[model samples]
Target: MGVFRIGFFNIFIYLCCAFLYSVPNVCGHNNMCFDCIDLEGCKAPKHFLKYMSAVDRDKVVLRLPTDKPDPMMDRCLNTGYTIKATLNGTVCSGSSDGLCHAIGEATTNFTITYSHCGDCYIACDCYSQENGNARKEGPIILTMCLAAFYTLIQ
Candidate 1:
């Protein structure tokens, strides 16, 4: 009985550790990439393009606006840019805006892609090539660990 109890407690402790480590990633907010209006040569509010990750860049295409007869549209959206990865602190490329590029890969974590733009500020969408698997996996793993611990304790 004592051995069983110790084993159960040990399992519980291990599960607790797992849960603690994963909770932050699970509950953490998603990343985002935002494209703001141009802020150059205009007195209008400073609206700038913001790209959070590579996945988001793939979703949207950067094009000069032709819908309206506004000449400023082309200037605002057509700012040739490059993406830099914040993870490894490296510059990926000088490609057009909204292009995604793989920066680095990790064994336990997902591959990170960064848009040409640097750290984004203001409104933007999150980018993930793998359909947010990394964001979802953390919670699932924690839940499984907790369930196994509970079964052992009971």
Candidate 2:
């Protein structure tokens, strides 16, 4: 029994270490928006407005239309960008709440309705905090814990 207890404790410690190691890769940098640039230089003049939102692991890229003349191109040319995440129809910002972790860490369902650089706003789709590995990790961790527990008990 004592040996089993020690084994369980070791497993618990290992799991905790694993979770900590994986967390940084999952959370990533949030609430940062920036202009598009290539190795040669700025890509703003390519007709498509490339805006990337730094939220999760996968970068969310927005491509604006080039037809019919767009004022957004001029606004986003050489300026910084700001992103706002919305939760439950309420605007999330530095005042309301930080753009990425607006409501809270658990707040998943939200839309990045406002992504602006200079005077231009980039339209985006609904975003979820769960889109990151955090969501998938939960179930995986639970399963691992359960399996370990069952093995120890048996």
Candidate 3:
């Protein structure tokens, strides 16, 4: 009976380790949004005002922790870029080298992961372009026209 109990404990430990390592890193994920700091007040360029659409808070699963210090800075080179993340319902922002972690209770630093560990946000600057991000659900007429134009040229 004792031997069986010991084996079960070992199996539980193995399963826990496997689950912990399976989480995806958030910063490296391929999601982007408007570059503007103020979503409600920022206006898109008029070039294709038709191409513009309201920011979808629905898709903003991760609240960019812009109000706090960035936690992803590369300590080795002392070089980092500003980024955002959320911890325990509070927004935290700080310098990061394209990666970050959430500092929680008792000095527990949890690695930022996609959808599970903490909320991660990506703004326009993260993708290196102007506010070029537009919703696929934007004006279908304009989107269809653009698609048609590309097809004809190709």
Best of the candidates, lDDT: 1
Q: On TM-score, who's better, 2 or 3?
A: 2
Per-model TM-score, in order, reads 0.26, 0.26, 0.23
lDDT of each: 0.36, 0.33, 0.31
- lDDT by residue for model 2 (61-125), tens: 23334323223222332222222221122211221111211111222233332223211222211
- Each candidate's number of clashing pairs is 12, 0, 9
Give me the runs in candidate 3 sitting further than 4 Å from their true place: 24-70, 73-154
Off by more than 4 A, model 2: 30-38, 43-154
How would you encode candidate 3's per-residue C-alpha lDDT over 14-131 as one tens digit per residue? 9998866543223322222212232222222211111011332122233334533323322201132222221222122222222222211122233322321123223212232323
Which 10 successive residues of model 1 have the least lDDT summed? Answer: 36-45
Error of 1 at 57 (Å): 8.1
Which sequence of candidate numbers ranks them by TM-score, best first? 1, 2, 3
Q: What tens digits encode model 1's per-residue C-alpha lDDT throughout 80-138?
A: 33222122322122123343222221123322222223232112222443346888899
In terms of TM-score, which candidate is strongest? 1
Sliding window of 10 residues with minimal summed lDDT for model 2: 95-104
